[model samples]
Target: MTSNKEDYLKVIYEENGLERPVSNKVICEKLGIAPSSVTEMLSKLQKQGFIEYEAYKGSKLTSIGGVICIKLLRSHRLWEVFLIRYLGYSWREAHEDAHLLEHVAPERMIDRLEAFLNFPETCPHGSIIPKNGELFENTQLVKMTDLKVGDIALLVRVEEDGDLLDYLERSGIIIGEYIKIKEKEEYEGSVEVLQKEKSIRISYKAACQIYVEKRR
Candidate 1:
C-alpha cells in the first residue's frame, strides 16, 4: 500500500474511527490536506473496501482495513520503543523517524526488534503497542479534561504531537507520573495541575489531548 493510504488509516484509527464515524473535517485537519483531497481519498478507500464512507456522515474502517492499520501501528510503536530505549533518543525525538521507518520495515525485522526490546507494552509516549495485529484494550483511560478539581490521576498516554510532547517534557509530565488537578479556569477552560509538588497550568486544548487514569 502507498504511504498516503497507510497514513489515512492510521489517522482514522487514532481518532477512534473504530468506535464511530470520523468526519472528513477531522481527517482533513489531522492530515493538513484540503477537504477535496480527503474526499477523493475517502471515496477511493471506500471503493477499495477499506472503509465505509457516507457523504456527510464521514467514514470508518472496515475489517480488512483495521487489520492493516493494527499491523502498521504495531510496527510504528515498536520502532518508537526501540529508538528511545536502545538508540538513546529522547521521547520527543522518536516519533518522526519511527513513522518513516514503519512504512519500510519488514514484519520479520519488526518481530526481532520487538524481541530485542523485551516486548515492551507501550511506546515512549505511552500509547500501547499492538501485538500480533491485536491491541490490548485499556478501558479505564479517560481524557485529562475529564478530571475535576482535587482529583488525582496517573498520566498514561499523550497525543504524539511534537509541540505537545516538548511542552509536556518541559513541564515534567512523563508517563506514570501522578498529577492532581489543583484548579480550573472556568472561563478559559485551562487547568492547573500539581505534579511532584510543582504546579503547572495547561491549556484546555492540551488537556484534551492527554489521557489519564483516575487514581482510586
Candidate 2:
C-alpha cells in the first residue's frame, strides 16, 4: 500500500483509540482533506482490509491495520526523540520534520535510532511512544478547559500543530510544568492561567486541545 494510504489508517487508528468507530467527518477535520476525499479513501482502506467502514456510523481498524498503525507511531515518536536530543530541534520543529521522515525511514534504521535514544517512553510533547507489541492508550488525561479556576494541573500533551506548539513554547507551557487556572473569561470564552509566575490567556478552543492532569 502507498504511504498515503498508510497515513489514513494511522490517523483513523489513533483517533478512534481502538475502542470506538470514528466518523469520516472527524478524519476530514484532522487531515484537513475534503469530505469526499475522506469518503474515497475510507472505501479504499476498507477494500484493502485495513479498516471496516460504515456509511454514517464510522470506521474501525482491523487487526492488521492496528499493527501498521503502531509501527508508524513508533517510528514517528522515535524520530522525534532523535531530533530533540541530538539534533537541537525544538519540539515543534521535530514533530513537523518527523511527520515527513517517518514515512520514508526504514524499519531497521528506526530500530537502531530507538536504541540510540535509550528507549524513550514518550515523545517531546509527552505522547507515549509505543514499543514493539505494545498498544498506545492514553490514561488519566483531562482537557485543559475542564480545569476550574484555582485548580492546578500538569501540562501533558499539546496537540500537534505548529502555531499551537509555538504559542505554548512562548508561553512556557512545557510538558510536566505545573499551571494554575487563575481566571476564566466567560465573555470571551478564554482562560487565564499562571505558569512560572506569569499569566497566559488562551482561547477555550486551544485549551480544549491541550491535555492535562490535575495536580494535588
Candidate 3:
C-alpha cells in the first residue's frame, strides 16, 4: 500500500473507525486536507476493498485494511520507543520521526528493532504497541474527562498528537503520574488537576484525548 493509503487507514483506526463510521470532516481535519480530496480517496480505498464508505455517513476500514493499519501502528510505536529510549529524542520528536519511518521500514526491520529495544510494551507517550498484528485490550482505561472533581486517577495512555504531547510534557503530565482533579469549570468544561504537587489546568478537548485509570 502507498504511504497515503497507510496514513488514511491509520487515522481511521485512531478515530475508532472500525467500531463506528468516521465522518469525512473528521478525517479531513485530522489529515488537514480538503473535503473533496477526502471523498475521492475514500472512494478509491473502498474500491480497493480497504474501506467501506458511504456519503454523509462516513467510512470504516475493512478487516484487511485494519490488519494493515495495526501493523503500521506497531511499527510506528516501536520506532518511537527506540528513538526516545536510545537516541535521546523527545516525545514529540520521536513521534514525528516515527511517522516518517513507519511508511518505508520493512516488517522484518521493525521486528528486529522491536527485539533490539527489549520488547517495549508502550511508546514514549504511553500508547501500547500492537504485537503480532493484535491490539491489546485497554478496557480499564477511561478518558481523563470522565473523572469528576476530587477524583484521583493514574494517567496511562495519551492520544498521539505532537502538540498534545508537548503540552503534557510542559505540564509534567507524563505517564504513570497521579492526577487529582482539583476543580472543574462548568462553563468551559476545563479541569484543574494536581500532579506532582503542581496545579495544571487542561482544556476539555485535551482531557478527552488523555486516558487514565481511575483510582479506588
Model 1, C-alpha of 191: deviation from truth (Å): 3.4
Clashes of 1: 0
Q: With candidate 3 superimposed using the best TM-score fit, by how many Å does residue 1's alpha carbon deviate from the native?
A: 1.9
TM-score of 1: 0.88
Taking the candidates one at a time, how many backbone clashes does each contain? 0, 0, 0
lDDT of 3 by residue, 106-204 (tens): 999999999999998888788888877899767899998899999999998888788888887787766878999999999999889999998898988
Residue 85 of model 2, lDDT score: 88
What lDDT tens digits, residue by residue, belong to model 1 across residues 141-175?
Answer: 99999999999999899989888888877877668
Q: Rate the local accuracy (lDDT) of all candidates.
A: 0.89, 0.85, 0.89
Predicted structure 2: lDDT: 0.85
TM-score, every prediction: 0.88, 0.88, 0.88
As for candidate 3, its clashing pairs are none
Residue 120 lDDT (model 1): 90
Candidate 2 worst ten-residue window by lDDT: 131-140
Worst 10 contiguous positions by lDDT, candidate 3: 168-177
Q: Give model 3's TM-score versus the native structure.
A: 0.88
